[model samples]
Target: MSTGMPAYDESGDRSRRPTATNRTAAQVNTTALLDRLRTAGPQSLSALVQHTGLSTATVNRLVDRLIDEGLVLEAGRAAPTGGRPARLVGFNARARSVLALDIGSSKIAGAVTDLEARVVRRRRSAIVPGDDARPALYFFEALADLAASLVKDAATGPAPVRAVAVSVPGVVRRDTGRVEFAPSLQWYDLPLGALLEERLGLPVRVANDVNLLALAELRHGAARGRRDVLTIALGTGVGASLVLGGGLYAGSGGAAGEIGYTLLGRESLSTPWPGFGDLESRVGTAGMLARMRERTDALPDGFGPEDFLGLARSGDEAATAVLAEVVDDLSLTIGNAATLLNPELVVLGGGFGRAAADLLVPAVRRRLQGRIPLLPAITGAELEEAQLIGAAELAIDLAAAAPSPPT
Candidate 1:
């Protein structure tokens, strides 16, 4: 269970200290320095001192220790000044690795990335339904197998991994690491974090898939550095993730963005929809398909939400009409979310979001223009794997922020 970091120095050592106050400043300084390094990359000792507002001696000592621990490295010299150019120190991204898992209703996608969020390995697996009696275990086994395979293939030189971040398609409480409910997956109160951590022998972090996507966007995509933002992932289920004050906003029960359960129109027996009273139940891919089927018996094979969008793009009249209705419905939903959250920007993401980007963005924008006096700017996610990409981010952020245990 030794994580390979120097936990303590019991024997006589020049740097070892027995008093808490002796190490308090170093700990605080390191945390502050790490944040700067993350944001601005490598810097000279003078630059670090100025950025962290720490003394030059303290910055130099911290940078030296980080370099010795392989957490940082001396890159080239800074620009030629009058004297010798100070050695530039930068974060050694390869020193730490993280595994990100994107668990979905019908498939699982995963990728291993370095501390800098560079993907080292990627894998995907189809998630066929379990015997209905043990769905949780079935999905878990698939995830474990994928993690094991990735770890085996990776170069294990680094001290294992700092953590694993799993993105689930529902409300995820960060404190408990429990997935409250993933209606698309029909999961509830599942200890997904503990299960993965125990199975893989590493720390595990979990978050709502849409929320994670928003985190990814904020970190490295369209929503970078934005304070108030909303990301709506349109997939098997419609969900929203909000970021306020530069941090993701999860409600009291971690159910802040369960937009799928919204009420939209009345239900009829002739059109029996899954989760029949819910709005997402009415407009989700399946619902749209069911309605589409009523109009045309010759529905295209494998006609899901993505296909519907493709058909719309191809100028299929039926498909266009269906997508138009979806756009209108989604526009209304977006307006409601915008009015309430008043986010700086609203990003449309996930499988449906990407495919219907051509359709959804314009419709949502137009809806906002007419409905609200003030509208948040609308945009589509740039990444193909927005959810999985965000999963990587969640893992790295948690690992960097975890507290060290006392000796």
Candidate 2:
């Protein structure tokens, strides 16, 4: 039987050769074993072998390497089955910390977390929308300071921060960690990751905010155990993240899930926010508020999206009408996406999405039922600080992949 592996040719380009096949396989096996240990709590070498289908020797070697790197710990032995007790191994979740930053349109938030992405400490600061003098630099400095303060305050003095992960409200170039565009934050073509790494003196990973939320949901929230999930964030603006085949699918340009830019109607150059797409311009917070203001002068002072939703829920006719229009637009957008992606689950998230879920979900569900053959379960986000949690998750993955230091 043929192995079905790529053939090696002396004249062919060296890069085309499957030189790292064995190495890749080994890495995958190691990750699988580690995941099992992390999830199953603790297991003996025999149990790990049984769970991962790897040879006992391979499991032992990987576990030993992980133990040396402080990523795995040899817990006390398990209870004796017949003759001898087996030594159990477990993931070392407190080995190192990670710093996460959520760079939102309105504010910047930071968190320090353990290996399992549990927040130990958090800090947040508001960002002035139209600051012309090095706004990004100032925010980066603040985040670095926040991280340092958290580390200093930890019970364990100056615990090592393995990596820094940032969630930005924009399209990011995954390869170079550049912010290609952020309409809400007014950032464009910025080398944000490198700048943050310089300020914090640590490895940095940056991703789109909605993408991070999707990752959080996939790992710890509503989308757990499900692949082909779509998470829609409705807040100051509309955004989405797509998780396909149990992985975050950043497209060729790292903008695969930028559903906010999907055109819903005719383009309008005269719109105040030029690039905000039709779907977002209609159903987003600003759009909803504008629609409500147009229909009713009775809106309470300092009215916001949540306030309007509350009023709508209480049977206020004008507020209800505004919400109905917003829901209809959201349904159209979501229905179009569902028709294309056919995801298993659709998660509603972000400030407005979570707040209006009670009203929006049922309405969207009804609309989808008529259009689509199979409707996905729509739900709100389970995690409160999803962007921060997801950033920590990305940091944890980066830390796990970093090379172990020399003994």
Candidate 3:
């Protein structure tokens, strides 16, 4: 199992009983169905009825409730020379907003998004060196201020902020909201969720930054509509998210998808690769740079990975050799993952993954050509702020999942 962090449960239990709701199970199911429709895009009533196996009358009633709640809106008429034009329904992009915040080692990024996850406002600020604890606190305050400012600019009446989604560079347990380990930010076992919830006065959902990126992609990026997908983030640290049956497979303890720690040299090489040393040893963008430095002296003094890619592009022999090594390693790792997980789509993401696409994709494809049965389709993220965008979706999901607040 991929391991990074333990799931945090404030109640201190692995299993908890479901709450008795004011509504029936069927009602809850109908509400969830409507939420899905909003996120996935507009659907006709017949489509909903067919997909959900709900009766047409029941689906109609549910849609009526959602329309009244301002969650879903009528877009237009579906095409047909039918008796009556079908009313197109989709999420109201302006109904309310979700705040997504992504805390990276280098900077803090925030986005204000509508219920449909369309970003309206965005802000990014570099981290200031000081006590590590203070930066998270400060950035969140700034994020909250940005959110308030955005809300004020909108014309919607008392648009209640749904929830805050935070993606941190560490292993997070959303249930209890703890950071088991975050090498880039140098945080360990931090009570991030609860603290953020308390500080922001909004329910907070915390998750690994890469996982959020994967979630974003699954929902709206290259992996959309793919039930089995594997997204590899190759920048600072090599991490992955595996989607099984269209939902994130977080494993037994929220530690799944930590593919960076996958033991590499065991079968392929004679030398025993003592693998990913410590925090920062195997995680993040800097970690990869450090590994490159240890292996070759051909790189320049102030070289970044981009420079290496440039050299490879220019056919510089030494740079090509180093670049090839990374591709080979990555391809081998991906091949192994493919053999095991058998995901339908394998999306390559992160800064490095995006920059070295010319180098990464061909190599990954070549590595799996004869080795795997059906190679996963490799693709890149379409959006620049996929992780930040997904964070907002996570927050909205949490808010919607919660028992409706007291009337």
- Clash count for each candidate, listed in order shown: 0, 0, 4
- Scanning candidate 2 in windows of ten residues, the lowest lDDT window is 7-16
- Give the per-residue lDDT digits (tens) of candidate 3, residues 173-291: 75676988876665678787777666666677788877788877876778766778888887767777877766677777777877776666544344343434232234345665666
Candidate number with greatest TM-score: 2
Q: Is candidate 1 or candidate 3 better by TM-score?
A: 1
Q: What TM-score should be assigned to candidate 2? A: 0.87
- Cα lDDT, model 1, residue 261: 69
lDDT of 2 at 339: 81
Order the candidates by lDDT, highest first — what do you get? 2, 1, 3
Q: Pick the candidate with the highest lDDT.
A: 2
lDDT of each: 0.72, 0.76, 0.68
TM-score to true structure, per model: 0.84, 0.87, 0.80
